[model samples]
Target: MSDTLHPLRVSNDALDDGAELRARMADDGYVFIRRLFDPDAVLDLRREMLQVMQAGGWLAAGTDPMDGIADVSRQCTEGDPEYPQVYHEVYKLQAFHEAGHWPQILDVMGKIIDAPVLPHPQKIARLWFPKFTRHTTPVHQDFVHFQGSFDTYTCWAPVGDCPVELGGLAVAPGTHNVGAVVDHRFSLGAGQLQADAQDVPWLTTDYEPGDALLFHSLTLHKALPNLTEDRLRVSLDNRYQAADAPIAEHMLAPHLTQDAPGAITWDDVYADWTDDRLQYYWTERGGPVVPRDTSYSDRGFADALARAKRGDADARLHLERALRRDPDSDRGRQAAAALQADEAPSR
Candidate 1:
């Protein structure tokens, strides 16, 4: 792929009609809205998150919270037992919950999904530390992970200013039409398809607070690695779908289970909340639950894996093809493991 980055065409909220916005999403598999929420609100959440990080000894002692300066010496390597503990704390903040349900965000989601929408209760917060290449999210589609309605949309917003170098998201335009790709496991706890990104034009921009990207569930997207050695990148991933649509059972669960070490119970997270309305909102409605499509063979992934195991010269290519065809299947995971071993250096 070219080193040059292409700016995603921004949709002006005032100028774009619902039809126009929907058209943009259908064409690009995502719509980038500039200043969709209050910038100050976003920064406030950033400060709140940083305070939590500071308490966890993840931030530099003297730096301003808004700066998000990481304590390099104190950084915990990936898979460290304490790492998930810190993430669990970040997930429990009131600010985090409030931001996920911000009114403006829901309004936009309503327009896009064209129905009553319920934002998934389990929100994801990404904290990207500088120079941590393994921490960068790999290129993957969200549909496999979230097997709810195919119409589900993910709204990603930076909690603070995210320059391109700060590792904002980059998406391959119109990749949703390609359907689910076979995905291999990567660092950063997400699956990555091994297909060359050069096959599609990638779009990204310097994201300011309030700017948000709403993408289709199957869109191919990835995070740009944080290049700055001192700064931290913080962002939110919140999903929304039509209320009548069947949803995966896991989407309603808390982000960190109570069983996980250092996880706070949902009861404790809601204890001080003044608004009782937000609690158990989805369950009270009794929405339909749907089983996620976890089968990968319908896309011929099994055949591809069989060919690869036969010592085919194009084994890697076959695996990539399998992933592109049915990323949600069990075969996709097997294909990923085979590809990982293929890439590993010999002893």
Candidate 2:
């Protein structure tokens, strides 16, 4: 893909017309709305999230949390041993989860879906650090990560103003029209699976605090690298689907609960929350639960193992992290064997 990014078409004018909104979504595979949220409310959530990061030693000492100045030395991504320690703290914020269910978000999603919307219980936040481009989220469809239905939609919004250099999301127009999930391969980036975008043109913008980009589960998209010198890029990417649609079982748990040592349960996340309003709210309203398909990740891990044996640095690094994260698990043992095989002398 070229370094150039085309501007996203703004769909704010269609807010009142569900037909127009769904038509745009059908034609473009996405709807980008500016100021869909109150900027002040976004900034307030940014402060709350960043304050947690600051307390966890992610931000530069003495800097205001709202500034989001990273310390750099403390940088870690989703799979790293050190990441979930701080990430789960930010995850614990009541406001962080509430942002997913904001009425504006629900109304917009309801319009686009033309049905009652159910926000997935696994709310997500991307707390990215500067200069960590290798681990930037790769190009992929949401279905591979967030399965159960192709009708699912993802709403991504930056907590603060996000310029291009701070790693906001970009989507390939009309990619969802392909109608099915594309083949995905292992990647070192967030979600770990990457799709083949080939030559598709991508669209994005220097996102403001309240801007939202909503797209289909099959739409191709990726995060632009966070190229800033000393700042952190924080954003939210939450999933929604019709209230009656089937949802994967795993989507009901807290995000990153599968990661070891740093993993946290919903109770752990809710222990410090100020209210019970949103807690377990999905129990009554959640869609029909289906078993999560592990094929995507299983294939990705197999690819990583093969690449690691060939001395691919990124793949080897992924294997090493897996080994370190959990030495006794089946995949961890596979990773250890791959790394060991890679180091063996020639026959």
Candidate 3:
């Protein structure tokens, strides 16, 4: 890995003009908006997240929730069978759901896409534990995983201050133009694509609360490893596309499905939420649900698994489709296990 860090071109001006904003996104693949959200509000959400972890005994005893000190001895590795169950609970937090529709974030999305924005109901909360390299997200594009709209934008915001050493996001500039790259197996998560840094440099920054990184679904990005000794790196990923565009049915579902016994449910997440306005907002709006493009079907399990064994980048997607197509079959179960071994978290 190169020690050189390239800073993302910051856009501080309000993006009132749709043409200019769209041009920047098309050209750079991402636009870093500084202080788009209230930092204090972001901190409150962070505290809430840490509280959930603390209550679950995931955090170190006698430490403040904000401190995010992990009890490593009790911490679950990415490979643990119960890791997904634990992650499911964290993903269902009400704070994360609320953050998905933050007015400021939606405003930017609306302007850039030049349409009424429809934020995806399924939000992703990345809780990267310090010193746990096994769960770090690999360099990959969101398009393959979220096959709804080619114009979909993902907004990544850290819940608290995140310096480079603490594992912020790094985007391989101009990779969106190259489209999806072949994926191979990687030690952490499912797999990652090796970037040609000489052609498309990796750009990143010391992200702070309220700072958001907005990028296209095809933009290739990865999380830097959490090198800190004790603190945890918590971040949120919310996606948006034009309201008129066709959306994948799966995107409308909850972030984590109740497939397993201990899985989190929508009711559990919304139990304390007094404001019901956000509940099923998209469904009520009557957005169009289109058939999901399953292009990965072309790469069958045998070929994918064979490639996976040799660390092919597309292995995860192929396995995922298998499970989606036949979750109850013997092959489906095997696919599920393979995904688990790869530590593929729910997007």
TM-scores for candidates 1 onward, in order: 0.80, 0.98, 0.82
lDDT of 2 by residue, 1-347 (tens): 24678999999999999999999999999999999999999999999999999999999999999999999999889888889889989999999999999999999999999998899999999999999999999999999999989999999999999999898999999999999989999999998999998889889999999999999999999999999999999999999999999999999999888657547888998998888999998899745899999999999999999999999999999999999888999989999999999999971
Model 1 Cα lDDT, one tens digit per residue, 1-347 = 23666998898753347778888888899999899889999988999899988888888888898899998776543233456567777776877888889998888888888888889977888877777765467677787667777788999999999999898999888988876654533222233233335567778999999999999988888888788888888999999998888898767777645224445666866876777767777885556997646453233344445545554444456455445544555555777776766556761
The alpha-carbon lDDT assigned to residue 31 of candidate 1 equals 92
Best candidate, TM-score-wise? 2
C-alpha RMSD of candidate 2: 1.4
Clashes of each: 6, 0, 7
Model 3: how far residue 143 lies from native, Å: 0.7
How far does residue 65 in candidate 3 sit from its true spot (Å)? 0.8
lDDT, candidate 3, at 142 = 77
Candidate 3 wrongly placed segments (more than 4 Å): 77-80, 179-187, 190-199, 258-262, 291-304, 307-347
Error of 3 at 294 (Å): 5.6
Question: Against the hidden true structure, what lDDT does model 2 obtain?
Answer: 0.93
TM-score, structure 2 vs. true: 0.98
